[model samples]
Target: LDIAFIVEGSDNVGEENFNIVKKFLERVITGMNVGQEDIHVTVMQYSETVTLEYSFREIQSKESIIEKVRSIPYQGGKATNTGNALNYISKHTFTLVNGGRQDVPHLVYMVSSSPSTDVITRPPRSINVIPIGITPNANIQELRRISQPNNPIILHSYSTLIEEAPELVLQSCCSRKLWTEIPELCNKPMDVMFLLDGSSNIGASEFEEMKNFVRAFIESAEISNTSIHVSVLQYARENNLEISWNVPQETEKLVEMVHSIQQREQGPTRLGRAIDFVVQNAMSESHGGRPSASKVAIVIVSGRSEDTVEAAALSARMNRVSLFPIGVGNRYDEEQLRTLTGPSAANRIMKLQNFEDLSTMITLNSEFIKKVCMDPVRECIDEDGNKKKPGDKWTLPDQCHTVTCFPGDYTVLESHQINCERMPKPVCHSNLPAVKIEETCGCRWMCPC
Candidate 1:
């Protein structure tokens, strides 16, 4: 979750009350776990103009954030410019460059005791705006207009607001385990293989967590040899096959093998060798990898590979195998991981703080694989963010979402950055592929008219 607090610093706000607001924020920050993958909080003080007191990207620790909050000076101005502040946040603050992930929920809390000088229209981005009125003088009607529908305005004096700060913030940053309820894609035939890093860098404890992650993933999936064939391989200097595609169509047996699989420690991280091993040994028809089924290889890496990995990963993709490289530790090379994962790096390459975080990958991995198997026809996108030409063959990065456009005989109008659902009804006449929408809006493939 990404949260931004927009505090009103007009002349109406006395220093004592402003200090209380800072304390309220301090309490809120203390109660939350502020980290890169977890909650990130930013603060901006607004009067006639918005002043960014601190960005979430800069402060990852709760102590650091609270200390910075304490140091923030009051920017008292003549009147409140709430509309301009919202506009500024919408245009500049809430962006990927500013540590904002579009997939996560964004929330804004506005603290004010006065009316805005301008109208508060809906911002360009989707965000839940909460109006926190500090005094009875605050405009209730304006708060209603600015806030999310049915979300009550938190109207209280500075002292009272400080007291209820913890409860209010908890409501905004509650556990998102409920949000992970994605519908399972049943009866989708897929041949999925996992290439796990068991190098010394990963250690025994971390490897155990990785195994648990695989087990959880298998348990969540609707697995059967006919439905979704599963395979597991541990790799370092060499690869050791734990489970094969030809294994019985029993989920229990597969999970049993996952639990029994031991670590292959004290080997150099020759990840390239492991990639080639999957392409040559696992992805073959004789190895229970159905050519018609969705073929995917998930590579989990803890540290930098001792050998080159890009070419071998490319080879697997050329053979119609989707590649997903998960970089677990902070020591792993990010660029190399991106190269191995291919395009759409954000969705493909998952960087974790430690092996303990592998549990989080279970949901993401299951959903991504299921989605790809539901529709395996992935179109390649170019560096210019345009769809690849027909027959200009390319491999899709792992979790690469694409929408095929049908161009029969009519002129195929090229549209960019549009919602697929909002596009005109598919009346095809051109020679383009039919527009197939994926579950995520991350796809930038061509959408036909």
Candidate 2:
């Protein structure tokens, strides 16, 4: 569970009003049952609204989190432009939010004392935006701007300030043993770099497969709905740019663009070359604003390659972007295949194990892409702002609730990310000391494990 908070530190408000805002935030934090270890706190104070405070990661102790929340100094000036604060928090802070991949919930809490006169042109990226208006005159437009009236995006008002703090915790970290498994993808923008194999060794069918996988991801999760922007080209016989940086939200165009891929070109499967392409590109785009989610992922697929993928895989791993390599067949390098999984067994690069069924393979790949895009796709966007792209969507599991970094059901978590393809399997971590659910998985017929 990852939690990010924003409180009005607008300069125009009075000291008394400032204190009320701080206390209101503190009470809510205390009541959320947010423990020290369960959350990473970021304080954005708005006077002229520069991110007055940055994030303090993983404070498990509620007192520690509260003290940090209280540490926000009061500043008052003119009208409360909550939109600026929201813009700052949306752009400047939040990349470290852990539960981004649509598997773990990410929660953004906004407590404001005034209104925002500006119209947000940038889109909002996080999954759930919870806006609580502390003042009677608090900007309802800003509140509605941050939230959706229906579903997870909530905009509820109180008659007065939160006079009393709830004595009990909203939810406990340890008690919610299932936290990691729950499908809670945040609406924070994510930084994703995809590395594709362009070598001639990758076949026509495989090329089409790769292209569609990218297309589905671009259409279903990218564009206006997500923060994921895919780059690079097919590395086969010729190297060409299919998508530079922009990702299409609507599937029709992306699908058309990909299906129309008449050229399958690039050099020898330079897997390392592709990974390096992303690393170099990503470093330059590092905007100062704290993104809604932390880290990025490098995805690679190849059938054959002369150079080793170890160095590239390790480099991406160090950058906090995991290297996911898909091996096309027995001829593909298993060592490199395994290497992409990284240092921990949990990070082991998983193979399709069977490729006889293209539909299953494509479905599995699509599911993985959906899970991966959920967070950064959420992060890279500004909810109240203009839609970057439109006609894309990724729905969360029912067990999931509005993002709060809250713990989720135990069985649904596998790698702390959800893969919808394996429905009813009670996805779980195999490396863990124990296994809980006994129910069989939906793909049991195909399982030879």
Candidate 3:
């Protein structure tokens, strides 16, 4: 990776604070691998003018780089021209002559205490803004505009810079993919159990579809002993453990096992018994349940349970086991599913028209399920600064965009575009005119005769 630090050297950040900034850079650089073949770093100080302290080609070893940063004198000026600094680095710093490679990823860190006096434009490379000491005067919106999306680091005072150096180093070492992708996509340990309904009410074909749904979910997840440990159980009159979490299996092998699972279409659906069995036998330490891992159960139901489920569901929740119940067909009682999910039924339960709909529903809602498994706390802060739970949907004001908060660290924003060409033209009488009215979905024509 190639990194550039654009330090603010204006009068606002006095000589004492400037020394602290240098210390911050030294600590961050020390944490990273600094060699000719590895990370290359460039340092520039900007006030009314931008001055290159060093380029990537000037320093190679970690010790030499630390010494150079310590020896460099502060360039103090009256005005903070951040735009000039960004433009200078984009033109001169990241070039072949300066030891910048085409294959290496480029990152720019802008440390500033005052807003730019000139117009700030987005640079070609990825930029992260670090605003320190002057939060009230810092142009947060403009800083965000110039930096990468959601990539601004704010510090109340320069004294806090040393404390945050470790996290800054960690962020610097991350690959470009990790920075661009959703934060929750980062792996977390989870123990997931698929509790299948294999009663007589569901046909053999429907049971196969259920298996396919489970297989699809497993295929998409990062399955390993340290990541997501999966187990499957088929329940009817009796419970059959198809796959045990205790047995360590690769993802491909697990998928094959799920494919070979035959339907146990025996007596009536006794889902309550299955729930109780999982809580007692499946989620125990002896059964391969990790104490640190989040426990999740995806229960697929075909019809109403022959036994009561409310008490069993309550027990599961009390043990910190999250239950997501997918109700298939109209035969199952909606109220029972709601009771099974307890207070958060609206978000936890999914009702499908038939077994065939499972594929489509899984494709669309897989992220939602993954979020549930990864984020045990089950809350996210949206762009509007509003607290939202998983499955909550809201429309953006004055725009045709809808935002949904999934369980993880990200929120999905969907645009509802109007297909004006598909709509037929409205007819108007000779004496009256037609008026166009704007609606959330599209435009509508109103005529008065």
The weakest ten consecutive residues by lDDT in model 3 span 175-184
Q: Which stretches of candidate 2 lie over 4 Å from their true place?
A: 1-186, 222-227, 236-240, 247-250, 282-300, 345-348, 353-449
* Local accuracy of candidate 1 as per-residue lDDT tens digits, 1-449: 78888899888897888999899888888888788878888899999999998896696789888999999998888979888998988887779888777877777878888988777775543676767775568875566456523122344578877786556556544643212333456576788888888788777767877886676567556686556778998898778888888788576788778878988785689988888988988678787778768787878887888898866855664456777777886788887787775563336666787675565444323444454455433555442345655445332343232333333211122223346655555555776766665643233335486
Runs of candidate 1 with Cα error greater than 4 angstroms are 1-182, 344-346, 363-377, 381-386, 391-449
Model 3 residue 218 lDDT score: 68
On lDDT, the leading prediction is: 3
Candidate 3 residue-wise lDDT, 1-449, digit = tens: 77788888898888998999999988888888788988888888999999888788886788888898998898889898988887887777878888887776677777887989987767774433333333546665466456533234545578867886446445534423322323334277788899989888888878877886776566556677667888999999999989988876576788779989999787999988899899888888888889988888889887889998865775575566778889988888887787666654347788887775564343323454445555543444433446777888887554676767666544565768676556765777755766677777787767865
Query: Per-residue lDDT of 28-123 in model 2, one digit per residue for the tens?
Result: 666654544445455566545555454544445667767766776676656566656667656545454532223445555566656665555332
Q: Give the Cα lDDT of each candidate.
A: 0.70, 0.48, 0.73
Clashing pairs in 3: none
Error of 1 at 419 (Å): 50
- TM-score of candidate 1 relative to the true fold: 0.47
lDDT of 3 at 22: 93
Q: Rank the candidates by TM-score, best first.
A: 1, 3, 2
**lDDT accuracy of residue 4 in candidate 1:** 89
Which candidate has the top score in TM-score? 1
